[model samples]
Target: MAGLPVALAAAGALAYGTAFGLFGEDARTTAGAAAPAWAEEAADGFASVDALGQKGTYGGRGGPVVTVRTLADLEKYATAPGPHVIVVAGAIPVNPVGKEIKVASDKTIIGSGTSGHIVGGGFFLGPGVHNVIIRNLTIRDTYQGVWNDKDHDFDAVQMDGAHHVWIDHNDLRHMADGLIDSRKDTSYVTVSWNRLGNNNKTFGIGWTENTTADLTIHHNWFRETEQRNPSTDNAAHAHLYNNYLQDDPGTAVTSAYGNYARGRTAMVLENSYFQGLTNPVIKDATASLVQRGNVFSGTRGRNESGGTGFDPRRFYPYTLDAAADVPAIVTAGAGPRSALGTPRAAATRTLTVAKDGSGQFTSVQKAVDAVPAGNSSRVVIQVKPGTYREAVKVPSNKPHVTLQGMGASRKDTVLVEGRASGTPRPDGSGTYGTGGSATLAVEADDFQARNLTVANDFDEARNQHLTGHQAVALRTAADRVLLDALIISGDQDTLLLDTAAKDRPGRVRLTNSYVIGNVDFVFGRATAVIDRSVLTLKKRWDGTSAGYVTAPSTPAGRKGFLITRSTVNGDVTAGSFFLGRPWHAGGDATLDPQTTVRDSVLSAAVRPAPWTDMGGFSWKDDRFAEYRNTGPGAGPAGADRPHLTDAQAADQEIADWLGDWTPAAG
Candidate 1:
């Protein structure tokens, strides 16, 4: 017909595609396991190749992430400038039917679990658009009730003159026209692990005059479709392998053909299974086509091949699934999976907490106490809108726990406590230290907190007699911790982003949130990514003492804190704040503290020389640097101020910080 296409549950690794580099291309699907890195997907095939001076198809990896539910918000972000990782939460109907939303360059539009659907509409990519990925979505219901009637041009995804695009793991059907229409010399594209069926004019590649398109179509199941089967024309390199194309009974007439190569297109078709199809493979006399190791079943008309097509291995490396296992692999592993949005492979159990005796527990801590110890599955402690003046802790044994607030704003549901660092413990164990004074301390892995406020209201101004005023609002020493839309407030040492030990891997991602403090408010040894958030530099309790923002004591050869696309400002004097200083924890010279403030706005509070020595460790001896900072406080790098070059900043990205792990909402 028309067109063709974390376990981290994380096991059963099926081998295929590019199984190298930071991203693994193995397919894994089992109960409580993931279907590859669905939450952290990057391009793999021809789209992953660097061409036209663009570095592969990594859509919105360096940009902020946004979640949209309505059609207007979806359209607003899809056509916006720069890049974004947009999560579609539910079905967005395309009004008046057959309407196509024009998506701009550098966007990753993925589904939130299996609920993201574009109803009666599709997406369109205009000329010169590049680096776009549309994955794990159901784009359907655009049928005009007239398949043979060719009046509407409503396609599931139509791209013209676009480059470096990847369409994967989606359910696209019931379209008015071709399911995927790639025209006007679109190149460096990959279509993998998609199910295309129940229509005519399935896939059409190339309606342009130039032979510039490079496509990799693999592991796609084209079922119950009539024709096209991705008819390629004037393609420079069209590599089709391990594709399962099966035509239902009838509809395979003289005019219907599968895998048509026309107009001098160089095509390589191999290891594909074709069942119950007429004219399974055909090529024009002038085209360069090569066919080998293809399995054909039932009936087929013309499976002809001639001329020597160009080899694809010279361009990029890719592995293929066996032709016999194509049916089993594509059918079971295709479409929008439920585990794509979830971090765990098993079903998540939920527990609610409210203050006024309306929930399962009276306080947030009580709900956390109710969780079964050493639990294997995810447990969500939903907190209602209330201010619970108590401490909350998730121990190391209690992993996969999320404390989500069921409130309209993050300010509504508050988990607060008043414990200064020097406050003596009731158990006579001495004072609660800076790390132990945290109102909310998460020591478990796979932790998440959203739409909540964690504050250590220790009254630093009232406690002028105290010596230690380090009040921590939140301290997390774990892996894969995501804090979204939260407000962490205190005076000094507010948020401690740490690791279990010097050898363990501890990573945290904080986005669309706020962290307010003065002295080393956001400090730790973890590889933390503070993205698109606000880091307000508050005045000290005396209202004149200037403080630092971050004090990282990262281990040697390990990454530290990364604050990107965020704003650093507060109600303080000009040049009163340093970006960060190296903190050699426990006077350990082996710890190399580092902090990078990149693509962020620094108000008048930040000093020109934003880094310095701490605990006898020189900042220059470590990895402290800045890149592309703006606003009044930003300046060029000197001997005292380190700045990262363009090439250097490219290497230190979010992907480099959080390796194979992609943080998701619990």
Candidate 2:
């Protein structure tokens, strides 16, 4: 057994002796089992002066404390409201201790510090408790902490299925489910300023799920807590803000999905910090989202494939300056390399190499500058691999900008690397403020890149002082973009898939390709599908485990990322990856949800608890799903892993996203 605290041990013994003096051996033995010797003694000393029915007992009198020593005694006394404050200050036994004790409405529970703890094996709540507050306690090693089996109950605290409750300044660690939980229609709840760590080996809850509930999670530290299959129903409303999160080597923090129904809707997120781990966030949402002013500086150290991806434009809503001197746009035609080869049957148009002195430019951007807007057919840019070192952009008006390479052999074709500053021009001399270092920026609708490799080979490790230095390989905010046989590599948001259309849904297809990055490097809100592709996860030498493969910020009511028939391989562990999570609190649950990994292979580096929070919002109401994935990370399909039906896979409209191109395979 682990060592017990000295104070609790001494107090328990004294309390047992007092029981012997007051109610004979039966009470003494019960007291002995309830707490440590020291805790019993303290209880005895306090009990001598304390009475069961004192005038100030129920109110906040001189700690007119209601002390229940044993689990049995606690159970007996917890039925009615005898005191304003209840203290469970002992080492409860390891056996089945019945269920949770639902505190009376407006009651408070005071316990030991996070270090000072009690063991609640399986205690549950009674129905219809409201306005309860639980603080400064540690409940651990239990089946469910404060479970509410009843429906429509509100204003309770300290355990599973708590609704309209306030839980603050407590520590819940090493539980099989969630640290705090709620249930059906449970609403108007607030959970703040708590230390929630390592619990729930299974898919359970501490404070969770109110199908029609409204919850607020703020200023709490969720460290090393494991979460799975939180909620898929769109009716749950959640708000998360300004909290500290640390989970480096455990399961993810949150999970969301719409159950059979449309699922929970409405969510908001704001300023927070996450660190000390791999897979910091996720979003499986289908609702529109509004994300603002949050920094994901550290806490993303897994090279696992399906981890972190989202749109940077939505990260800090106020920081978007599109008119800034971003990278030069690449749109015109070059040599025979510019000729794009359509499938044997779908040849809509043939390429005409630009022989005019001014029409032919060395870099891809020069070509883009020459093209006219709104071309009907796709403009193919057949690139020959000698490293076209320049930043390129395809404007929204240009529409089609296809960079076709020699082939997939890697030796014949390569779209070398480069980036544009928020202020700098395409050449090395210019200075672009915020949006620089982007090798390729696509803002045009229906943009496609085949047989090309884009990279940002900037020396970030050279003390460049590039804090928000996004040396991106691609920043795409277009509708219907197709990347076939493409390769992207960089650090800190390498491939920004920004699909943030409020009304219409955009589409993206990444096929037979490879992408590598660090940090929230591959993040965005693109309704994308990565079919038969390879995600290569790279390691950072800084000893910081803070790089995820993907982070999707898919808001409510829009199409999100869909990854299928892919391979996730890297040097990281399975436990380091996050599948997806909600991006905003109280978000539209039926909006675009992040989905991936059907019929795929995820490396062992992907963590089992693959879902976590978006900003501060828990993803219990999002639509994140994975199906029939094989690898060391593969497990039986459960809440976290839902096998997609063949019909559902076909309906996702993946073919249209790949426009005018067919993958080598069926």
Q: Residue-wise lDDT of candidate 2 within 89-116, one digit each (tens)?
A: 4334334432455455434454422212
Q: In candidate 1, which residue ranges exceed 4 Å CA deviation?
A: 1-345
- Each candidate's number of clashing pairs is 11, 144
* Per-residue lDDT of candidate 1, residues 1-666 (tens digit): 000001101111211111111111112212233333544567887999988878899776555566666788889889989977676765677887899999999998887566567878899999999999998788886777786648999999999999999998888887889889999999999998888987788999999989899999998888877777989999999999999988767553233678989997999998998988888999988788899788898856898899989888998888878888888888888877645533334578999999999999999888888887889777999999998999889999898898988887777788999998998899999999998899999999888888887989898778878779899999999998888878888888999999998899899989877788889999989999998888877777776949999999899888899999988987789998998998988899888888999999999899988887888778889998999999999998899888997547745666567654556554
The local distance difference test score of each candidate is 0.82, 0.48
TM-score of 2: 0.43
- Models 1 onward score TM values of 0.57, 0.43
State, as a TM-score between 0 and 1, how close model 1 is to the true structure: 0.57
